[model samples]
Target: MIKFTLVLFVLVSGALFLFGSSASAQNGTLFFSPATGSFAQDDSFWVNVMVNTQGEDVNAVAAYFTYPEDKLEAREINTANSAMTLFAEKKYGQGRVEISGGKPTPGFSGIQQIASVLFRVKSSSGAATLTFASDSAVLTDAGNANILNLVASGKGAYVLKAKSSASSSPTPRPSSSVSPTPTTSSQPAPSSFPTSQPQFSLSDVRVDTITGESARIAWVTSEGANSVVEYGPNKEYAFIVLRGELAMEHQITLENLSPQTEYHFRVKGTNAADKELQSEDQVFTTGALQTQQGKEEKGIFGGRGLFIGGIIGAILMLLMLVMVIARKRGESSLFSQE
Candidate 1:
C-alpha cells in the first residue's frame, strides 16, 4: 500500500485572454475593427476583434461580445490567419459570442487578428448593439494577468433596414471614422420595417458523449440561430458556453470540468426575427478520464508519455529488490539448517 501510494504521488504532477479597450494601450486593445455598419434584413456581414499588445509580450486572449438576438444572427467564427493559432474555445449563443485563444511559448505582440464573426441581419428595421463584455481579457504570458483597460472600449451599433425592395437602393454601411456607440440616434430603423417578431422552436436536440472534462450538446432549428449551453455542478448553473455563429444545426462543447459530478445543463438558442427556443434543465454525472497506463492519454498535456514509463520502472525496481532479499535469506538458511 505504501508503495502504491508513493507511485501515485509520483505519477500525479501539477499542470497549469481578451478584454478591454478599443483603443491601443500599453497592455493591449480588444476591439472590433469596423465599429459601425448598416445592412438590410437577411444581408450578412462580418466583423472581427483585433489586438495590439503595444510592446507587451502576451500569450492568451479571450473576448466576449453580445448582440441583439432579435436583429442579428451569428453564423460562424473564422480563425484562418488569426494570430491566436491555438483556440481554447469558440462558442456563441443567446446573442453572445465568446472566444478564448492563445499562441505558443515566446508569445505574441504587435497588431494581429483574433477572430471574425459573420452575422446575418434578421429583424427588420431595428437598431442592434454589439459590445464587449466587461469580463473579456488579454492575459500576459509571464503571469497570466489581465491587462485590458475597457474604460470606453468602443461599442458597435448597426442599423437593420427591411429587406430591400426592387426599386430601393441599399444604404451603404457607414464609415469607421467616428464613435460607433449603439444608440437609437446613431441610425434609426425605417418606418416601413416589419413589426412582427417570432417565437422560435427547435428539434432533434441531443446530448452526446460526455467525458470527464467535457460535454457536447447538439440541436437543430428550423432557422439559423445562435447557440448557448448553460451548465454547472447543480441546478443553479452559472457557467455559459456559446457558439456565436448562427446556423440551423448547432453543436457546442463544454469543457474544463470535474469528474463524477452531477451537472445540470440546459440549451438556449435565439434565431433571427427575435425568436428564442430553450430546453428543459437536464442532469448527468460526469465520467473519469480514460487512460492507458494511467494519467490522461491525450489532452492539453501533449507530453512525451513519461508518466506511465516511470511507474513501470518503479514497479520493476521494487520487484527486483524483493527478489534479492529473498535470495539472501535462502542462502542464510545454510542448506535447510544442516
Candidate 2:
C-alpha cells in the first residue's frame, strides 16, 4: 500500500505543475475593440475580438459572443439567421467568419461567437440590455492545444416612444381664401365664428358605419367655429344645410341621406357678418341601417330570456321546499304514533 501511494502522489503532483504552467502562459495576453457603450435604436455598432497568445503562434482557434435580441440585431456570413451580421472592423487582421447555424447550446451558449458579431437595433420603445461572450477552440498553428481566458461584457440602448394625441374636436373651416361663399341653401345656420384669420387643421380623421339615411359626424379641434356641412352625391356645388355649432367638435346625425350612396362634404366656418371659410372635402358612403336595428332587437330578446329563466328557477325552488317540508312532517307524525 505504501509503494502504490507513493507512485500516485508523484503522478498527481506532475499533472498539477503542468496545469499551472499552462495558465500562467496565457497571462498578459488580451484582445478587445473600442465601442463599449449605449447606442441608439435603429443604428449600427461594432466590436473587435482578439486573443493574446504570449508571443506564441495561434492558429485554427475559434471565438464567439452573443447579444440580447432587443438590444441588437446581428448577421454573420456563415450564420443560419442571415438577418444578423458580424461587422468586419479594420483594426483586426482580415479573416472572414463562417457562422455555424444550429440549436443554441444549453444556457444560450451556442449563440456566442469565437471572436465578434455586429449588431443593428431597430426603433424600440424601451431600453434593451445586451450581453457578449466568447469561446476559444483548438489553436493549431504548431500543435499547441490550450483554450482559455473567456471574457464577457454588457451594454444597453435607448429607443424613442410615441403617444396618441388628446384633442377631441371637429375640424374647422379653411381661411376665407379657400372658400369664397359659406352660405347653405340661400340661408346660413345660426352660429358665431372667429372674427380673426381662420386657422384650420384636421385630426382624429376616421370613418363611421353609415346606416339608413343618416351618419354621425364627429371630430376634435382647438377652436370653436360656426360649422356648416356642404354635401352632395355627385357635383361639387350640390349642397345641403347642417346645424351650426360653436363647440370644439360637432357630432351631427346627417338625416334623409340615401342608403348605400357615396357623398362628399365640406365644413364651412362662418362669421356673424356672413364671411365664410371652408375645410377640405371629406367623402363617405352610407349603408343600410336595418342591420343595426336587428342587433339591438337580439340584445333585448337575450335579456328577456334571462329574466324568464330566473322566474322558472324561483318556482322550482319553491316547489322543492314544499315537498321537503311535507315529508319531514309526515315522518314526525309516524314517530309520535309508534
Candidate 3:
C-alpha cells in the first residue's frame, strides 16, 4: 500500500511539471523582431527589442546587448512613436547598445516594443548576431520578484552578402578592405543628425526669478526624466546641479550669485531612455543684491556726500573772515583821519 501511494504521487508531479505555465515558466520573455535576415555590406537595418509580460504587470524594462563589432555597427535608437513615454537610458557604442524604459504603476502588460536600433553591416559573406546581456531585467509591479524569471530567447541573426557591383567595385582590393570602416561615417545624415541620438527635448524653460543672491529655473518635459541645471558666469558652465528623480515637471534653484552681473546658463536632462540632452545657451542677469551689497553701495555714496559738505563749509568760513578784516581796516583809517 505504501509503494502504490508513492508511485501515484510521482506520476502526478510529473504531469504538473510538463503542463504548468505559472512557476515553471518565465513570466517575461524578451526577444527581437525579425530574428533572422540577410543583408549586403553597408546595408542598414532595424531590430526591435520586444517584451511579453505574460499577464504580469511590469513597470520597468532594461535591454542591454552586444554584437560583433567587426561585422555590425549600431547607428541610432528611435523612440518617437513608441508607447513608452519614459526612457531612463539609451547608449550605443563599441558594438554595444543599451535601452531602459518604464512607467509608473500599475505597470504594463502584453507584448510591447521597447525601442528600435538601426545597424549597418560591415562584413561581406559572414554572419552577425545580437544578444542581450545577462543583467537585463523586467521588473514586476508586484512583490513575488520576476515571480519567476525573464529570458532573452529571440536573438537577431543576419547574413551579410557581398555588395552589388555598381555600388561597390570589387577590383580595388585596398579600398574595399579600408572602405567598410569609414563608409557609414562618411554618409551625411544632415536631416537626422540631431534626432539620431537618444536625446530628449526640453520645452517651456523659464527663468522663474533671478535675484542677486539666488536664481530659480523651471522647465517641462513631454515625459518623465531626471533634472539638471548648469549655470556659470560664461558658456563654459562652471557650475552644475542635478536632481535624480523621474518626473514630468522639473525645477532647480541656483544660489550665491553676484549682483548686477550677467550669467550664462543652460539646462540638461535625460529622456525616458536616460540620454542626456541640453538646451540652447541662455542668459540671465541678476538684479541688485538685496542684502549686504545694497548696504555697501549706500555706504559708498554716503562717503562722497560728507566729503563735499566739508569743502563747502571751509569756503564759507574763509569768506566770512575776509569780510571782518576789511571792516576793521576801514575803521582804523577813519580814526587816524579824525
Q: Tens-digit lDDT track for model 3 on 141-257?
A: 564244324343456667788887874555676668877767667666664786766445678988998887678988988678777676788987755554546678988877667
Task: List model 1 lDDT by residue over 180-258, tens digit each.
Answer: 5554455556432534543367877677878997778888887887776777877766455555557988898766668
TM-score of each: 0.43, 0.32, 0.41
Candidate 1 weakest ten by summed lDDT: 9-18
The TM-score between candidate 2 and the true structure equals 0.32
lDDT of 2: 0.45
Alpha-carbon local distance difference test for all models: 0.70, 0.45, 0.72
Candidate 1 segments exceeding 4 Å error: 1-26, 167-338
User: Over the stretch 1-338, how does candidate 2's per-residue lDDT look in tens digits?
Assistant: 66654554353333333432343333212233322234555666654343334334443233333445544566532323221222112121122232221111111111122344565665455544332234323231343334344432222223333232223212433343344454543343343344355555434533455777777766544566454455678646343343334556756555567788898876554433333455677888998657777888877785898878889999999999999999999999999999
In candidate 3, stretches whose alpha carbon ends up further than 4 angstroms from where it belongs are: 1-25, 147-152, 166-338
- Kindly report the root-mean-square deviation of model 3 from the true structure over all alpha carbons: 21.6
Which candidate tops lDDT? 3
Worst 10 residues of 3 by lDDT: 12-21
Best by TM-score: 1
How do these models rank on TM-score, best leading?
A: 1, 3, 2
